[model samples]
Target: MKKYIIILSSVIIIIALGGIYMKHQYDERQEKNKTAESELYEKAKKRMTDYINANYEGIDKINFSNNYKMDQMGGINAEGYLNGDKSKEFWGIYDKSNNIITSSYVDAKEKPACKEKPCKY
Candidate 1:
């Protein structure tokens, strides 16, 4: 009877240890996933900035922040003051798949504006 009791206790301990190890592994995996997500977001933002710079020289010199958009053909949207001038603000939209800037609009005078619906891209 004593031997049987010892065996049962040992089994319970082993099972408990296993559960603890699994929980630790799960926590580690979650941390890694979070880190990967952050890295990906930063890389995408950089790509967006680079794309804008390639087209509009020196635009990348200014600080630009991007956010995930979820409305109306969602994509990464970034807007900031151009050439450090608040009045010259510009906004850009990056493609969701390639993280490439596809459309950009700058505030300027005497610009051909689009106010009507079904504007051609």
Candidate 2:
């Protein structure tokens, strides 16, 4: 009976340790995802700002939306609307791997352009 009790106790302790380890790993993963999201958001925001500033002179407060889509591979797609003309909007894709604007296109037509200014999306 004593031997059985010792084995049971060991099993319980191991299970507890495993649970704690799993929880810690999950938390770490979540933190990493959050960090990545924020980084992507900032990059997308900048892409929009640069586009508006270049396309239209003296346009400071163009409407910018947070990253609308985030891929597991750290790719992001977002849209920005011209402040003066809400109907005019552009979208851009940010590739986190190279930390650069992969593509941009206007809403009216999907013209993929590599230019950083005048976002192509």
The RMSD of every model to the true structure, in order and in angstroms, is 6.0, 4.9
- lDDT by residue (tens digit), candidate 2, 47-71: 6566545444444456766548887
Candidate 1 — what's its lDDT? 0.60
Which model scores highest in TM-score?
A: 2
For candidate 1, the per-residue lDDT at 91 reads 68
Clashes of 1: 0
Ten residues in sequence with the least summed lDDT for candidate 2: 108-117
Note the clash tally of each candidate. 0, 5
* Model 2 Cα RMSD, 1 decimal: 4.9
Task: Summarize candidate 1's per-residue lDDT along 15-90 as a digit string, tens digits.
Answer: 9999999999999999996676556556556665554454444443555544444336645566666667777776
Tell me how far candidate 1 lies from the true structure as C-alpha RMSD in angstroms: 6.0
Positional deviation of residue 39's Cα in model 2 after best superposition, in angstroms: 1.4
Candidate 1 residue pairs in backbone clash: none
lDDT of 1 at 96: 61
Where does candidate 2 stray beyond 4 Å? 84-86, 97-99, 107-121
